[model samples]
Target: MAALTIFWDDLSVETALDFCEYLVRSEDYKLRDLAIWIQGSGGPIDELDGSIGSLVALWSWFKSFREQGLPGVPLGARAAYSVITGRPLDSPLEEGSRLVGESVAHYVFKVILSLDPTAHWAVRAKSGRIAHAWDNTPGISMDGGKHFGPAVGFFTNYPDRLSSNYHNAYAAREAWDDTGLLQSVELLYLAGLPSRPRSTSTTESILSPLLRDDHVGSGHREEIPIAQEMPASITNNGPVSAGAEELIFASVGADVSRLDQAAPLDELAVASVLAELGFVSADGQSVSAVTLLSHGVQVQNVDGFALVETHVAGGRLRGLFLEPMRPSEKEWKSITDAFSALGEKLPAHLANER
Candidate 1:
């Protein structure tokens, strides 16, 4: 009753990301073997049995893994995060952990860029949604939840992973089956091919609903009646190692009077206030109510904060939202303070001596 030994090393928790990178680079030689193992072994990795018939098919799988973030990724990403940062994937990821995550993502992006300059068709087709969400241009409305890039998603998590079966499958096999060849092939796949930008329509379809009036709290939808008091904060920045930056955009709604005490700040007034706060209109023009309604006035500062001033329910509700793209703690606090100051200066809070 000796423990069984396997020929190929199983993609384990510690090596998941590295193994995926191996798989991607060495698909020609390794993927076929993996397919054989999955098909013949009748084991847990079989969910992907018919999926890896060719390199193109494999790329599609990677594409889905990146875009959808299949279930098994969190633990794998957690494991990778620990290995990369030398820290446990604990809750309340501090600034150091956040930067490590960004560094990993930036490295992955650099890897994708280093690819062979010719992208696979599947990669090209899926390129529209590949950019990090935080890379959005000011004034443009697009999905901010898309943190996955071509190969970065694989680093975050491995997919179709069944825990027990992986251990059993590896123990059952008995050959040395080195991954040297696979590693070379994976390197070629990742570094040899670069993606081309896709059509604008593909991007438009994925725009954020938060920026779309027709989607939520719109005329047809039940209005989220303006609250009498502003909530201290509403943030989606969770503890996940990666994708946190993209989630940095926080929506805070408040009721404050204008500093002028003349009228509530309109889009133009908002733009002017933003200018004072060091944010420039995305298009270098005064924002009109029509433009604000269409695409919230996207103002970006050199300091990594983006603000989108929006009104919902046909102007009955005003919003003060902050989208910080990789801000330091001090920068975040500064941005929030600016928001508070902006709130006090607009309309009712301003005291006027008449």
Candidate 2:
């Protein structure tokens, strides 16, 4: 069926992190994958995600179109992955294939990010018992499995989607079209406006989750139980092309790549944010937890990699970016209790040990 996954499509980790400031540790797998790419010299990590399987699906896929023992992405998939990530695409090398490690990771990350969050909202699948695990939504059938995202162009953001009639009829009928709200998005001249014509509103724009520098100081304090949902195993797909990756590996790399690089005071600024978040210090002060929960501490991937990602700052706003996985109220309380305990002042004897 036409399994729509818009609920969490644009659900940015940064937005989820902003949902509770530094109080609730925002978890983001996407950023973690990006970090690994930077660490790999703009290449895919050799390790496999144990949650998915011991066999490295991505590595196997990349190796198929091996060029000089290095697999590269094709033009079509290359362009697609770039567009979906909101980046520009470049042509593949005619003489040799491009290295797809970085681009493929980014593409997969975006798709998984969109669908994984759906688990948190699968209340109906709980079987009347609460569990920290993920249960697929009843109506959200990802028929193509791992290949579905690429097939539907979800990875590349290709304009052509599978025809609605080709989808499972039963699932389509049972689907929730946002109760007709989504259908309301139509082109209009508006009551009064200039000669410009543009898509007025969309579920992607008006309703998409938003994240920004201003959002860094946002959200209230709360405990967020770490989520560890494993995505369904994806069989290997064939190789695609590669591009220049991100603007420059240097921007995301450990070295800032320039003498005039901006200072990483973003962490200190976040430390101040942690103080506001009520993290108690070892000396009976607060936000010491911020120090403990620095950039790569929270929100990990299936491989236990933290999604502590860095991005190019074009708007003069430089800082860490990330998301949150919503927890059940019970889980929330449990985490909150843990934080509350951590917030407690250290005992007299343990002061030095701390």
Q: Model 2, 1-354: lDDT tens per residue?
A: 222121122212433233223212322322242334323443333333321221133333333433233332234443211223232323343112222333343334333334332212111132222221222221122223222211212211111122242334323444323332122111011111123423222223110122223433225423332322222221122111121011211112233444125333333444443344333332333343244333333321221111223332432222333221232234223333432343242110101101
Candidate 2: segments with Cα more than 4 A from true spot = 1-61, 68-79, 89-286, 289-354
RMSD (Å) per prediction: 20.8, 25.1
- Against the hidden true structure, what lDDT does model 2 obtain? 0.27
Query: Candidate 1 versus the native: TM-score?
Result: 0.35
Off by over 4 Å in 1: 1-41, 44-82, 85-117, 120-264, 278-291, 295-302, 305-309, 313-317, 324-326, 348-354
- 323 Cα displacement, candidate 2 (Å): 16
* lDDT for each residue of candidate 1 in 14-118, tens digit (9 for 90 to 100): 333342343244323222332332233332332222211222323334334333433222333432223332443344222222222322233233233233223
Q: Supply candidate 1's per-residue lDDT for 216.
A: 32
C-alpha displacement of 131 in model 1, angstroms?
A: 11
TM-score of each: 0.35, 0.20
